[model samples]
Target: MRDVAVISFSQLLVDKAEANDAELVMPVVREALGRAGLQKQDIGFTCSGSSDFLTGMPFSFVGALDAVGPWPPIEESHVEMDGAWALYEAWVRLQHGDIDTALVYAFGRSTLGPIEDILALQLDPYYEAPMWPDATSLAALQARALLDSGRLSDSDKKKATAEPPKIVDGAAAVVLASGDRARKLCSRPAFISGIDHRIESHLLGVRDLSHSVSTEIAAKHAGCFEKSPTFAELHAPYSAQELILCDALKLDKQVTINPSGGAQNNNAVMVAGLIRIGEAATRVSNREADCALAHASSGPCLQQNLICMLEARA
Candidate 1:
């Protein structure tokens, strides 16, 4: 492996932030680059995760590129997926010897519409579209399935915690580097130890929503906890899904789950995943834990999942 690492990260809240999307992204990008001890010109490439649906227009991300100053031109791509996948793309690019540093980011504003209704677009528009079901209903279905399995009590299947998610609208950015460049940027870089994303079938009705088989599959491939993860941050939009994920990761009662609150507290679609990874990295950076598991999800009822293990070195 190329030993890529996250050197710096930044975030802005979703609903509470007053700035427009482009305005929100610029400072975040600047903060990330500033922490990396480099300027925009130093970045090897840039990748972002965002959905056009959220903005009600195509190429919405193209406007975001302006936040970074495109006069000079830079390598970049945008995914219809979440920022978590965008980070994955940058990680993959680092596999080659030529690239040393890159930037990844995501942004979402749920207040623009009934997010559940908007998310319906991710479905196949064929058989699934006819139902016109929103994410909440599908997650409820998953909640019911878990209850039926007798795996958890009704209370355990509730929303994450009393603490509200940081629901304000926001954006987040991170800079990554490999080899010597990584060492030069930070004294303790949160290395991209293992990263993987998996997607379940689009038809919510066909799959077993009760469990995160995708997470389990991702964990195995993602080389979980080099040591036991003392902390874990999972994207569970509902209370029930939190219980399901804990079971899927076999997280045991010992791990600190979502001290950063999680999606239930506040969520912006594109950046939420980046926030999860950032939370995990922060724990490692602060010397609170040697390793941590950060998970991000997309699609209805956790149809897609990404597991990233971040490790800190002495």
Candidate 2:
């Protein structure tokens, strides 16, 4: 595999927005490209993450392609998962050694529809989807399990149960370059030391909601436990889930958690996980952290997880 680093990242989040998906995505794409001192054509490959279900239209991501200006015809692909998975795909593409640089972006307008109902569609159609359980209710089931599992203290439980999630509109863009290409793009780059993702059984009842086995496996494969991370950007949509991730990752109080206030501050659906990665990269690029961990998740109640470890070298 080739050495790859996060050269530039940009993000925007709003409680409510009137702009279309393409309109919202364009600015961040421009910002990331501009920060990397590159133009659209300079990007060797491009990938994006978004959901047509949220947009209530098919090929909604195709329309967002205009945001990247595919007029000259650029190599691109889209994932129905979070933008973090898009970054994962770009990382793999870069490893092929055919591309020196790639652009990854994700956008979502959760305000467009009933987020709870839309997210419920992600559950098993035969068992869970038919029941039409909302996102919070499902999460609450997990939270209740964790509380009763004897894994958390009274204060931790109180902190976990504080408030509900607030869905927002958001988008994020990241520029990745390999080896020498990375050095030319930025003075300091957050080199991707390792990255991996894992998933668990889809059936909520059969899985252990109190613990994130997938996160532990992904983090181990990503080499996150090789050294203590100074910071962690976890894509926990709820406070209880954040606690679950902390335990799974084995993070201590000395480690900074969610300096960006996490998803609870701005839950942007598909975009939040990518924002976590961008936030961690920014810390490394700025020399605030020598090593950091960024995590993203898909599926209900933390059924799927991706962990990426980053390091800054002088």
Candidate 3:
């Protein structure tokens, strides 16, 4: 694989975005490109992540393309998932050896509707969706199972209860480049040394709620266990999920988790996971740490997880 690196990252998080998605994406996209010393034309590929369900508009991601200036026309794509997954696609595109750089972004406003209610629709229609259990309640079930398993002490449970995830409306963008192009874009690049994503069985009843086998498998594939990370930006919307992820990744107390305050401080539905990756990349770019792990999850109770291992070029 050709070396790919996150050259620049930018994000905006607020209680509510007063403008439309296109308006919201423009600033972050511009800022990210500027930070990397690149113009829109300099980007070889562009990909975005957003959900039509959030806006209740079909092809909502299409409108956001205006912010990227498709004037001269650019090779681009979109994912119905988070921006982190878009970055994953961009990384793969760079490996084709035809593209030297790519732009990735995500924008959404969960405040437009009942975020939890919308999330419930993703559950199994026959078994789980009919019950209409919101995200927190489903996560609570996972927490109860974890507690019952005797995996967490009473103190851990209390700690988990204290830090509930904060929901916000926002957008984020990242610039990626291959090898020499990456070094030219930024003095310090957060090279994507390893990246892998995995998903568990969709049925909640069949999976082990107490352990995140999918996360473990992804982490192993991403070389997360090969070298210690100085920090980790985990997209755990709930403290219980954070606890679960920490245990799955086997992070030690010495590793500072969520220095950017994680999703607990500010989370924007489709944008939060990408922000986790951007946050970790920013740290690596700033030389705050040599190695870091950024995680993004989708589906209720962390059914899908992606592990990104980033490191400074040696």
Candidate 4:
């Protein structure tokens, strides 16, 4: 496999609750294109991640495409998943050698519904769905398990929840390239050094609530989770899950966590996981982070997770 680098990134503020989806995403998309020294048409491909259930309307991504402009139908695709998954597809397409670089992004207004109940749809239909365990309640079950295990203190968990959960509405985008193409585009390219993702059983009660199997598997697939010098940006929807994942990955004090304040600080539904990846890439592009780990979660209690390692090369 070849290396791909995220060359640029842009994000809309979390506070823009009034703007519709198109208005929220346009600025971030243009800003990312501008930073990458390209125009919309110059992009070889485009992909996005978002969920229709959040807005009670399907094809939310189609409206998002209106931001790119008329006709000729640019090569693009959309995922009913997190933006990180869209990024994953973009990376895979780049591997085929036909595409040099691609743009990936996502937007959402999480406040549209009672987050807990809304997320229950991701659970199993037969058994778990009937119980109607909400997102927070499922997360709380994980938190309670962690506290019971003595892996984390209630005080330590407070670090992530010190502020109100960022029940936000916004969008994030990133541009990526390979080798020389990346070098020519930016003084420093935040190489997508490594990435991997996996899924666990969907039943929240069936899985070990205190651990993330997906995280463990993804770290191994990425090939440096055990011995690497990098800060980690994790999409821990709740503070306790962050602690549990840290233990599963065995990340130590050497690894700085979530300088971006993470999703617990501000949640944007389906796209929040992908935004974590963008935040890490932005740090590398700006030269503030030499190497970093970006993590994302899906399903209740992090039943699915993705890990990407990024580095800046001049």
- Local distance difference test scores for all models: 0.83, 0.92, 0.91, 0.81
Sorting all predicted structures by lDDT, with the top scorer first, yields 2, 3, 1, 4
lDDT of 1 at 281: 85
lDDT per residue (tens digit) for residues 1-314 in model 2: 68999999999898887889899999999999999999999999999999998788999898899999996999999999999999999999999998899999999999999998888999889877998998888889988888989978878989666256888999999999999999988999999999999999999989989999999999999998887778999998889999999999999999999988888888898999999999999999999999989999998999999999988876
Please write out the lDDT profile of model 4 over residues 55-139, one tens digit for every residue: 7797888887887773577789998888998999899888887778899989888877776787888887887778887777777
How far is each candidate from the true structure, as Cα RMSD in Å?
A: 2.1, 0.9, 1.1, 2.0
TM-score of 4: 0.94
Give candidate 3 regions above 4 Å deviation: 162-164
Q: Write the per-residue lDDT of candidate 3 for residues 114-229, one digit (tens) a residue.
A: 88888999988888788889888888888888777787877887755423467789999999999998998799999999999999998999999989999999999999999789
Q: By summed lDDT, which 10 consecutive residues of candidate 3 come out lowest?
A: 158-167
Q: Residue 26 of model 2: what lDDT?
A: 97
**Positional deviation of residue 259's Cα in model 2 after best superposition, in angstroms:** 0.4
Candidates in order, TM-scores: namely 0.94, 0.98, 0.98, 0.94
Deviation in angstroms for 141 in model 4? 0.6
User: For model 3, how many clashes?
Assistant: 0
lDDT of 1 by residue, 241-304 (tens): 8888888888888999998888787777778888899878878777788889999999888888
Q: Pick the lDDT winner.
A: 2
lDDT of 2 at 23: 95
| Model 1 weakest 10-residue run by lDDT | 157-166
- Residue 261, candidate 2: alpha-carbon lDDT: 88
